[model samples]
Target: MPQRPLARALTALVAVLTAAVGAVAVPGAAQAAAAVNYVALGDSYSSGVGAGPYDLSTCLRSEKSYAPLWAAANRVTSFKFPACGGAVTSDVIDSQVSALSIGTTLVTITIGGNDAGFADVITSCRFGSTSSCTDAVNEAKAFATGELPGRLDRTYAAIRDRAPNARLIVLGYPRLFETGSCGLLAMSTYKRTILNEAADLLASVTAGRAAAAGATFADTRPYFAGHGVCAAAPWIRDVSGVIEAYHPNADGYRYGYLPALTAVTG
Candidate 1:
């Protein structure tokens, strides 16, 4: 072959090989584009307390949890699920905030329930009289209005400082029961109603704080309407069989929370 023809053939071969490599790289690049650096932070609801098959025993992170489900479905670039079973607002600051960074593109948090002593209120109501339930509910309500807002602001501000560019989604707790006869282990209808009202107050405060902090609040009450502890098919645990009672079940995370998050993100 002449020297010019030989050089042309080599150039053609290189072009063909380069095209093949480019073609092979397209899908991976697209996949990367579809993903983002996501960090999950919050409490038992975010950690999947009643939803079993935990990823970590200490944090009680379940594979079926809404955070993991959402991350997997959305195809996250990197997911750090630092949510724990009994995390309060301070817990997120002390433990979970370290997982976030300026590089994080997305974050979801479910906190403040513990800060209002929600579990203690429920426990007191469960074992004590109706008056005790009312008292607990009132106390929780006061805290939700007065103290919790500040705590939530601190947590949200910390998250903002850590992941300034990330889209933070703050998820609120669902109503724990419907207005009817609960099971024997459950609180009375009136008490359940009061507790649900308290949950509503908490959600309101949380949503307000989240908005103030430049985050979106995902209200889960509508999603959990008929699926509370007293429903025919309850999504929340009726009793304290697991580590944290009154938390969502696997079905709740799948059907209730996942859809709520999907709607918000979409």
Candidate 2:
């Protein structure tokens, strides 16, 4: 119906005010979300020690590492790889945490194994007598239960302080041996059993500390089942070299560690 001029003017003004109110009600809805800034930090495991074709020789940073693979797959805004081989919790607190910042949205780490003297324990188990292997594993287990937690707490706290908003995922080591006999070269079943127990202890300690720090724990043990050093299709490398021995191979990173991480992140 034909309305008065004043009435039509008032109706137009009301429509404009309603549109203004709607704009004020929702803020930044039209703006895009922030991009993911991922920073990978920790020891060789995080640095991709076993995953070869390294991009950085010093840290053994490999393109095949779960960090890079995830970053590429997710198309993160930034990816920082500062994790070095043989890095302990101290090394991470001292050197690695520098890569993180408030903008970092995701962080992943595998540490505390070195602090527990992983290399020495493996060496003792491989070459020493069963008694020596047991002793070494016992000592490592003791240290892991005693001192490693504090170190991990410090490291995790440092990471949180640096990247306060990041979702930190702490990846754990798997049992290295499958037990039983695979060949003469394989260590004794007794040694294998103890070592697996030690790995379990470390995982427990690390998981507890991660929980204390409000971080997610990614356990790779399940994924690496039936894929230890003496398994038919082992993901962990046998003592082929000095550096790579007792470490996860490329396949381990791809199939085991990567999936474990993905499960937790999702």
Candidate 3:
């Protein structure tokens, strides 16, 4: 409106606009960072239960789970932490999710162990006096052989619905039995039979579902070889530190999990 001010304003505007266009024209001018939205969904394994130092309340979530590990490894920008301990197929499918950010780019999941009640099966078999967890081990075999495929399918579909565009990766459970135990007081006979079958079942089932869902399935079974119940360099070290109880140790997680992650994120 004023004569002198109008002239100065026009001059300043021209300088600002010119600078902006110059910045754009420059090659490799430090582009904006890419946004990575990762969503995690699953049970205790995914939640990293018993990983220590993390706060695990009702759902028993963990900050050190493979989900976060992969996120950190790849430098994920955004995350929806929906994973919790004891989650199952039914919970994932039926529950209303509050944490998912729309248009998420990645997701990682692991389930079905709770469904199989595999932990209980292990305990029950161990508790038996005559046989060293043989009957329970057989049941684990059945779970791997029988129930795993369907569970994987159902869980994959649910994730697809929630984040259809996201790159989904489902993880297989680690082994829990040893092939050549001393036929000891709690774990013997059909040595490691239950864990043997479980590994196979989890790998096959998740791989199949991942194919159908247009996602990736990371096979950790091979990475964990010789690390089961009686393994010398067992990837999965139990709570007891001697006998294979459940869950992969820190070494197993890094070795068994990292490859799977790089497969998808890379």
Lowest lDDT block of 10, candidate 3: 236-245
**Whose TM-score is higher: candidate 1's or candidate 3's?**
1
Clashing pairs in 3: 125-133, 177-229, 178-229, 178-230, 227-234
Candidates' RMSD to native? 5.6, 4.4, 7.7
lDDT of 2 by residue, 1-266 (tens): 46688898999999999999999866665433557888888888888888798773688888887788888877788998888888988889888899999899899999988899988998999999998999999999999989999999999999999999999999999999898677887888898899999999999999999999999999999999999999999999888978888888989989999999989876
Q: Write the per-residue lDDT of candidate 3 for residues 141-235, one digit (tens) a residue.
A: 67766876677777777777777677777777766656775434535545456556656766676678778878777777666667665677766
Clashing pairs in 1: none
Writing each residue's lDDT as its tens digit, candidate 1 over 13-73 gives 9999999999999999996686489999998899988888887468889988999999889
User: Candidate 2: deviation at residue 5, Å?
Assistant: 25
Q: What count of clashes does model 1 give?
A: 0
Residue pairs in collision within model 2: none
